[model samples]
Target chain A: MNELVGLSIGSIRQRLVDCQLSTVELVDAYLSHISSQDRALGSFLHVDADGARAAARALDQRIQSGDDLPRLAGTVVAVKDNITVKGLPATAGSRILAGYDPPYDATVVARLRAAGVIIIGKTNLDEFAMGASTEQSAWHPTKNPRDPERVPGGSSGGSAAAVAAGMCTVALGSDTGGSIRQPAAFCGLVGVRPTYGSVSRYGLIAMASSMDVIGPLARSVADARQVLAAIAGYDPDDATTLPHVNLSARAGQTSLTGRRVGVPKEYVAGITDQEVRDSLSATVDRLGAAGAEVIEVSLPTTALAVPTYYVITPAEASSNLARYDGLRFGQPSDRTHGHGAASARLRGQLFGREPKRRITIGTFTLSAGYADRYYHAAQRVRTLIRQDFARVFDQVDLLLTPVAPTPAFPLGSVADPLAMYQQDIFLAAVSLAGLPAAAIPVPTSGQLPVGAQLIGRSGDDNLLLDVAEGLEQALPVSP
Target chain B: MSDTTPTVEHLTKLANLELPTDEQAALAAEFRRIIDFVDALRSAEVGEAQPTSQVTELENVYRADTVEPSVHARTLVETAPHQQGTYFRAPAVFGGQP
Candidate 1:
């Protein structure tokens, strides 16, 4: 492994500040590492090697001029392709938008650039951020760096794999129904899904608008926290961004004494994998040993989360993706036919199997005569799901659950879409309620890493990070 | 709730997607399974609970009405697959020779 690639963001910053390592050298190291390692991993769809080198050179000159460095200076970050980076082909892992390159940067990308972070490349994802595995990606699937046969989880699989394999310091991934956290768990990295409205959604190709949030995947809780802080805050471009949001984690707080952690019984009830069950038990024991009170809590509507999420996400996705007609900035179809026919042909030919399935499902649910039963009912149940979290949060400061039922499953193992949807059973409910959740790797004797999810109340993102940091410190590193 | 499974033809027409004839049957089966799975939402008793379309409670967020400089029309139009001047070029909507 490259020495610079193994260094964390903090150590890299220290090295840069000490004049021991130049930003160009760091970027070159990562670029070379990516070029050599990424062919088999398939983590990146578009690597901006020139762009990254240019940015690093500019930063190195600034350092020589004695300018105050930005908070995340000298860090190389991989963005999931769905989030537009100015002049990069933001494919969203779909053929529909294959050659489309946005002329402007996403709010998060702009912020990361302003923070002196190098835009390394655009990582792959499931088509329109839909599937649990990168197998659904229009491009080749991203393999888990840990065990190449298994998936890295998705739709942020590429981002997770990039960070896991040390291709980048940290990467940004959008989470709607565990896209970020599941991949983090699979890759043995820390992934955060910040509370909805906490981070601006501008420039993100919308999948499920209401539940969509762009967060960070890093090897440490602290790195995730720093990246989240840089990208988070109000943006006029995105009306959903909350004003007066506080993202500061408690300073130097690592002890979990007197903290209240709840284990939702429903989240763990269906775990058939003995390894996952043992991992959860070990996580609970670690939390207890850290002086936190662990109590069993119930979220009865938990089972309804996947159904609700599937309905609502597809419904929103259908509407959001309606903008992808060939007339716009995507693949164009032969225009000998009428406009309507052209649109049908373009979408049919361009969209992958999962996006089409979702669009059809969304149209079905929201169609006349069916909206009352499926779409509206799911919305009402969404309220109940949120209430379940609201009720449980009143008793506990945070909740702990398994990030996924098992460790990363082998690539191509889950074929059925419904079976794949079941993978989010422990994750979708948090998304439905628009809560903040983090997936941290827990020690497991097995070859693959198991992740424990720490779900916090809405806007308590900092608390989640603080506790995760503490637990991360307490737990023995997985060998 | 009606027990009738949605036909793929109806859904494809509604969604404006042209599924290949060979793939429709497989997609139809997948759609049926998904619809059946999501039907579980109907079992939850959501008595008197209002729908939550957006999580953020902020409503009627309005910005100043004053116009701001926007992306250049040419810059925006350049991204389109086909463009005429500053406008996107598309197949005739009225189904006539263009």
Candidate 2:
């Protein structure tokens, strides 16, 4: 069961095609493993054992009948609770949405289902994808699979933890600002923050509308790319999704020859941890050795990213989260008082601390007198930050940097919100630029796994994954 | 550019949220810190840079005017906490019985 659970998507597909593994058996292994292990990890919020078993049985019948199989046949995936999966509770890791089972699947979920991916359950996340750590989840924090005492980096921490611990073959996670990549980095998995609007956000619980993207977390770069290919494309429902976009990496292309890889000086200088800095240097060396030209590039606006992200994200979140008035599909409010009072009381009682704080900050920023100074100023600065990436992309094909300043820290160690926001110092800039970035684990010698981030030009998701795959092969094996 | 600290009461009211009295002071301080942190944007030399609300440069995506089948009203109303014959029930807006 452990060996079957540990198979990659590629191996699983091959074995399934060869009739060596049955879909029901694989799904049962995962369901049983999750049932026993997820208690300690807190990676899953809701397990759809019946749904998974039913899907697996149907797929097994299809395989037995020699019917044409879908691309991701027999692969089991865990979805972040924020992405709706019709009839499944889509909590976004908040108590406010406790009993709200969505009426329909998110666009990505629909696409994944069509491609033959069986969803095992809804994974946990930071409430509304707000915090750097899963500690802010209204239910429970996900422990890092690498070190159970530490948190799995979030808000996609549960997704990362699930994929890392072999609870599922791959997991879907939403990245507003480093939600996917940071968690993947901490959990030692390959996580992609696909180009903004690359994956449809039709049913994803909106965190920050502009920056929100649904991507994949998987054990391998190939698996992440395959999942991205299945979910990415123009969706009429999402006007922002780019038309005629190709998200698939060209097969058999792993060489980094002639690729210009830039090591951002700003990212390197901001790293206070010696181990993480050493890992970055080692990754740069590997990139150079793999026949890529490595250069030091400066993104001066990097320092402004976290501040800009915080401002823009909260502003959008306050507006997006306004819908949870309890009249609709969420925890109902006590109407004994009045409508206005009930609405306020419902939000106050159900919203997690981080969401409330962000709502307050957002409301304050977008208020009449302060909008120009805080909101608009941050937007203009956001433009500058995007320009910084644009300029650097002109000089280099990709930027190599550490995913976070440090690896997974002990749970509850970083208490102050200000210090917590600073974790995205390296991540938020790329997100602000709306470019494709992936976090792939590099070899770590007896230390907590540190991931190296690869940022690509907008719409260059294929190139980013191809390069990450190349680097993944070139980097030394972790002991 | 004056350091005008807005009170939490006013902000939460605008946000349609309420906090317990004991937590208000801590939230106020945290809000101030966040405000001060984002204040760094004021120092950026962003003269004439266009404010980017949406990253995708696409504008005004339009579909065919023909209406398509949408989610059934009954299905949506079923998810509501309170419903009465396909209509979602809500608290009274104007001081009256709901």
Candidate 3:
């Protein structure tokens, strides 16, 4: 059973194709593992046991008839609660969305099902994907598999934890301001945040629409690449999706030869631990030794990312979250006791502190009196940030940096909102530029897992994943 | 700082949110700090550079204007907090029953 859980997607596919492992047996193994293991981790919110069994039975029957299956056939995948699955609960880790199940699957979810992968369950997240720690989740915080006392980095914390704990073969997580990568780094996994619009966000409950990107967190870069291939592409329903993106194709280069990896000096300028810095420096050395030219590149506007991101994200979030008024699809307030505005206020009260804080700040920033000073000014600064990335990419193929300042902090230790917001300082700039980035685990000064971030220019997702794989082969950190 | 930052009550009204009175003071303080942090954007010399709303080069993406099947009204409306005879119920704008 442990061997089955440890098998790579490539080997699993080969075994499944050879008829050595029945789809039912594979599903049963994961289901049992999750049933026993997930309780202490708080990784999964709801398990689709019957649904998974039904799908497995059908796949088994098809296999018995000597039919060929897709590469992802018989694989079990977990979904973050924000991404909708038909008839499954997607709470987005908020009490406001209680009892609400999406009527349809997200574009990615539907595509995964079409490719023969079975979704085992939906994982937890920071409520509305707002905070860096899962402690903000209304339900419960997901504990790090490395140390139960520490938090799995969030809003995609549960997805990362599930992968680390071997609860599922792979998990899908949404990254808005390092939600996926930070958690991936903290938990010792590879988390990819694809280029904006590379994957459809049709059924994802929007937090910050422009920055919200759905990606994979997996045990290995190869597995993350396969999962990205399965879900990425254009969708008619999502006009923002790129017209044609072949995320599944393997990059031609296997080595770092002739590749220029930029070390962003500004990314490490702020307060960071010695251990995390040492790990990043060592990874840079490893890349250089592998024949890639390593050079220091500066993103001068990096300091503006947090202020700019906070402004725009909230400004967008306020608008996107307005649809969750008590009337249509959220925790309902009794209308007979009040007027429309009052009832709406009551419904909004269902949200946790982080979501409320964001909504308030977003509303205030976009308010009539302040829009020009806050929203417009921030948007202009955002342009400068994007231009900075473009300038650096002109010098190097990719940028290497630390995923976060430090490894996983103890649960509930970082309480202040501003302190919590600082957790994504190294990552938010990448999202601001709408570029592709991946977080790969490396040895840390402390026992906890620390990740090194690899960032690429817009639409360079395939190359970025390839480079991440190259680094993975060179650095070789145990998952 | 107090004059520039919106009070918790004022922000709650604008955002259509409600917070308990006991927690409002602390939340208000935090908001003030965050707003102060955001004030740093004023330092950037944006000049005549146009603000970017979306990064994609694609603009005005349009489909064929064809109607397609959507989620069933019954299924969709079921997610609402209150519904009566397939119609979503909302609080009345005026002081009366919805």
TM-score (all chains, Cα) for each model:
0.98, 0.98, 0.98
Deviation of model 1 at A200, angstroms: 0.5
RMSD of 2: 1.2
- Tens digits of per-residue lDDT, candidate 3, A249-317, equal 454476998799999888867736998988988898899899999999898888888999999998999
Task: Compute fnat per model.
Answer: 0.83, 0.82, 0.75
Model 1 agreement with the true structure over A338-377: per-residue lDDT tens digits: 7888889889999999999999999988988889888899
Give one digit per residue, the lDDT tens place, for model 1 in B19-93.
Answer: 889888889888878887888887899999999998999889899999887678999899999998999988888
Q: Compute the lDDT of residue A114 as modeled in candidate 3.
A: 85
RMSD of each: 1.1, 1.2, 1.4
In model 1, pairs of residues that clash are none
Residue ranges of candidate 3 with Cα displaced over 4 Å? A339-342, B1-4
> In lDDT terms, how accurate is model 3?
0.88
lDDT tens digits by residue: candidate 2, A1-479 = 38888888788888889999999999989988998889999999999999999999999999999998888998899999999999999989999999998899999999999999999999998999999889999999999988999999999999999999999999999998899999999998999999998889999999899999999999889899989999999998888888878887344577998899998898888999987988888888888888999999999988889899999999999999999999988899898877888999999999989999999999988988889988999999999998888998889999999998888999999999999998898889888889999999997654799999999999988889999999999985562
Candidate 2 vs candidate 3: the TM-score winner is 2
Candidate order by decreasing lDDT: 1, 2, 3
The C-alpha lDDT values of all candidates are 0.92, 0.90, 0.88
lDDT of 2: 0.90
- Model 2 quality (TM-score): 0.98
What is candidate 3's TM-score against the reference? Answer: 0.98
